[model samples]
Target: MISTKRVFTSSPFMMLICGSLILALALGFRQSFGIFLKPMSLDLGYSRETFAFALALQNLVWGITQPFTGWLADKYGASKALLIGALAYMLGLFFMAKSTTPLGLMLSAGVLIGIGLGGSSFAVVFGALGRAFDPSKRSLVLGIAGAGASFGMFAMLPYGQFLLNSMGWFGALIVLSITCILMFPLSLGLKEKKIPLKEKRDTRAALTEAFHHRDFWLLGLGFSVCGFQVVFILTHFAAFIQDHNLPLTIAANALAIIGFSNMLGSCLAGYLGGKYPKPYLLSLIFFLRAIVITIFIFCPISQTSVYIFSAAIGLIWLGTVPLTNGVLASVFGVQYLSTLSGIVFVMHQMGSFTGGWLGGMLFDRTGSYQIIWITAIFLSILAALCYLPIQEKPLNVLKATMQPIDKA
Candidate 1:
């Protein structure tokens, strides 16, 4: 006799472990990218804007490709997508390490790696998990998986800096390339069958519904602010700190501080997602992020200020993720969760493009980051207001057709 309890709990735990490890590596390595900007630019003789554009393009590519990848994961399985993503990741890093020209850097870093990240990271992984876990446990499981990314960001920031100092940018990238192969085996653990009959719905209908939904766009718009706020900090905050005549270590540690706090915060947020109104919680997070950014920028700049800001920001960093997922799951059922969220992610990445590319361009034009920092604050406030109007009820269509067959 198959013990459903054992099967559900044990299998989900294993999948979480595997999914968490894979995401940790993917997100961690990607998050540490800022440390290489100065070194790569100096070595290759490119302007900061040029490098920033490549990263901006990368985010855009990731956003555009996410829907397709999410669809693939939902249709086939995450393992196959992970397999392809791993190859692209390794190959992209290899080319990035060898590239000596700007175009080559864009192709390797922006296009290929973007493809790799889209397929192997959170969307594909959690999309698979969505079908495996019970609805009651879904958000919590997603939250646990989301925390893995924060852990990666925390663990990789300092190590990436160390690699830059010891091995140089090219050598560091090569080492990272080699480390990416672990995604294959780890991804296999996520190869799960769909949960016992939940709902069988047309993916197209789901897409059509979401496109027409008011709150869907609201969530998408709000998420874009999150993308803008986080990416601007991740891609440029270190350099901003370095420009202050502070030690590079302070910048790296500052990022790590955000990572550590994000891990704790993400876990807590995931737990809270199960118990609270996800939209309200999400609004609270955005409001808190705005407050932290405002305080840090207002106070005198110092090592102490930087660390405090990082810690405060980290507490709310990826906290929005589980809440975001929770909202989607609540609003739209799980059958098409991955694809619907993928559409939302596209908006988020557009914001990422603006944040990453615009930051570099502004600094190049004005020689200051103050404007961009202020922009992040205003956008955070705007996003907070946006989330307030979202209704978290299940879709009306799902309500209509979800009843069981007639006895006759």
Candidate 2:
């Protein structure tokens, strides 16, 4: 018989490996959806806006379900939640393969896959990693796990395009379904952490308290911008490149560049989060994004410009995940991390919803993505400003109440 203690207290390296594998599988399948948009629209005679709406719905649904999924992951543990998520994700892909109408696509891609992603993506996996490691090493481990998503995008996005070219969109969906299902076996390696039956605080109260905290709101708002930037790029960057009269391979290569650079970005962010103030680092990232986007938009459109822009943006891509979660742990503590982080992620998803759909809608209406790019640049500036004023002190209700008295 295997030892339960050993499972619960596995080495950080072992935990990182398991978490990374799960993240790579979940994110790999999720990233491939972007590659399907144009092909699916052409085959089904759907407009870009129609597909955009479905992807938007997927983001919204994912956002709405994240809090609940995180709550479940916190209460029951990540293993079972991940398993169920994998099953749902696979089914969604299968159903997406059969979709002939926009409604069917919405149901499969938007609702089903959204819920699946909510339960299995970074939120759940990072929460598990957070629990398994000590505070000192948590950010590094989380960073490593977060890179799995970037690696997924690097590997799977091109692979998805290849699959589409080889087998067409329908066959690609079937293949993706098989790939998503593989997450199940990897999830089995994740052991559930034991929670005491009666805790000092219940999940509901924790969420309630987190909501009332001003800092949580700031974090949520800041995170929303991250979501908007990432989702907009992920959903439309390839198409945007194609619109510039560039080859599809150029678009694909740009995405791959982002993924490649993001690997280093995530690792560096993790190391920095361990030593510096996470919020300040986040502020710097947002500020730099604004500058980068502004420069890219104004610069002449060329293959070289695309590569430079992609590499710059990719470096900051998922770097937000580590700092965001690290801040949550720093302020709120790990006891309620999954739930609290879920709530923050809901805001992120809301931004994602807007970013994905709005980019498509604006393009359809104006025949240009320039406006959306400008909006992203503006929001990045705003996010940087917002982070500048945030106080990164720990959450201590008693200490907060005693502050004036202590000062007196």
Candidate 1 C-alpha lDDT tens digits along 57-123 = 8888888988888888776677777888888888988998998999998999889988888888767
TM-score of 1: 0.93
Candidate 2 C-alpha error for residue 340, in Å: 0.8
TM-score of each: 0.93, 0.94
Q: List the residue pairs that clash in candidate 1.
A: 28-152
Q: Which one is best on TM-score?
A: 2
Return the lDDT, model 1, position 376.
95
**Candidate 2: misplaced stretches above 4 Å?**
1-10, 193-199, 397-408
**Candidate 1 residue-wise lDDT at 357:** 92
Residue 159 shift from truth in candidate 2, angstroms: 1.4
